[model samples]
Target: MLRIDGKKVYLVPFEEKHLVDPAYYAWLTDFEVVRYIGRDEYLKPIQFEKVREYVEELWRNRYCSFFAMHHSGDDAFIGTAKINYLNEAGFSTRTADIGIMIGDRGYWGKGMATDALFAICNYAFNDLSARKLTAGAVSANKAVIRAFQKIGFLEEGRLRKKLLISGEYMDHVLLGCFREELHPVI
Candidate 1:
């Protein structure tokens, strides 16, 4: 099991047990939890079997890595993070996309996302030899955007009125960070 430790949290390979956990499923279906995820408007609540299959497939995909985030002090499962190569050519491009979701409501607003982002970014830059990392969030999700920015991510661009959430259009904020800009917390 791969594990990356940070000041407030640790990330381990997302596994079968995580997928089957009731909390995991609940987080996915909760509108409040995933409103910024930007799933197409026509999409319905996620199905269990489909998520299982997708996770299983991810396990074999060399270009993507998914991790389950846990609180370091109590070992509480709190969220998930992923690093995906931007091209099929893999490391040749030296670029990747990083995303994270803090699932447990109790962990929100406590810097858990920032800690996890630092750890994941360190892994991407050092372990994976990635030169640049990118991320995006719905403009209204200020917390997420701040977390990324706090970790040295710079605003890259924005897609104006690109996402429809709760019957309102919102901009999609794009961010990017070079390896040198990352401040590792792990």
Candidate 2:
């Protein structure tokens, strides 16, 4: 589990203990928020038992870093972030992929993603011994694309028709951030 504080928020691994939180599940399964998450969309709100089982499976996989984004004021679970897709092909152990979602629509556009990203970068470099991080954003998601840029991820390339959303193909923007390249004014 990775713990990050300050920036008025924190991120830690989501455990089975959190799955039973109805509020968390309700927020996550909210279609309004999940519209832009990934390759597939969840058809129905997940059952607590299913979510718990997923947490258990992920805990065992060790391929994903799923965190519960929390607000410091009340320690409330607001969203999530993940770092996965570790590549072992090269001699250098320097890069991984990142993904995040702010489940609480009420908390959107509040620098929550920025803060969470900074913490993730810190984890990548400090704890995971990584040198770089990568991510892909849907072409139409200006907020997310800009968020990645705000965190020092430069636009790398574009993949046309990479994803099908609502029966239409959408492009993807590949972006990256390097550990040695981040500059934090603290």
Candidate 3:
């Protein structure tokens, strides 16, 4: 199993055992937890089998690496993170997209997300040989945007009124960080 350790948390490869956990499904269904993710699938009642199939599909994708985040001290599951290569067939492009979701409400507002980002960024740059990593957030999500910026991700671009959150149209902020700009905290 692949495990990436950070200051406050560690990430393990997301596995079938995670899908069996009720809390994992609850986090995906929680509006406040996933609202910024901009996926309408969370708004409806989701079946366990469908979620299982979705995770299975993700596992089948060779370019995507999914991880389940856990608190270091207590080993409590806190969230999920992923790195997806943008290349179609080969990894020569060395560009990828990174995303994280702190599903446990108790962990919100802490620096865990930043730590997770640092660990993932380090893995991408050092282990995966990624040249650049990109991430996106709703403009209204200042906290998430700040986390990315805190980790040296610069504003790359924005899509105006791209995400509809709580009936309000919000711009999607794009951010990117080159491998050289990353400050590894793990």
Candidate 2, residues 15-59, lDDT tens digits: the string is 755666776778667877766777353545566677667667667
**Which one is best on TM-score?**
3
Give the Å error, residue 122, model 2: 1.3
Report the lDDT of model 1 for residue 148.
91
* Model 2 C-alpha RMSD to native: 2.4
The alpha-carbon lDDT assigned to residue 46 of candidate 2 equals 61
By how many angstroms RMSD does model 1 differ from the true structure?
A: 2.0
List the candidate 3 regions with Cα displacement exceeding 4 Å.
87-90, 184-186
Q: How many backbone clashes does every candidate have?
A: 0, 0, 0
Q: For residues 94-136, could you state the per-residue lDDT of candidate 1 as single tens digits?
A: 8888989998999999999999999999999999889889998
Scored against the true structure, residue 59 in model 1 reaches a CA lDDT of 87
Model 1 misplacement above 4 A: 41-43, 184-186
TM-score between model 1 and native: 0.93
Query: What TM-score, computed on C-alpha atoms, does each candidate reach?
Result: 0.93, 0.87, 0.95
> What are the Cα lDDT values of the candidates?
0.88, 0.75, 0.88
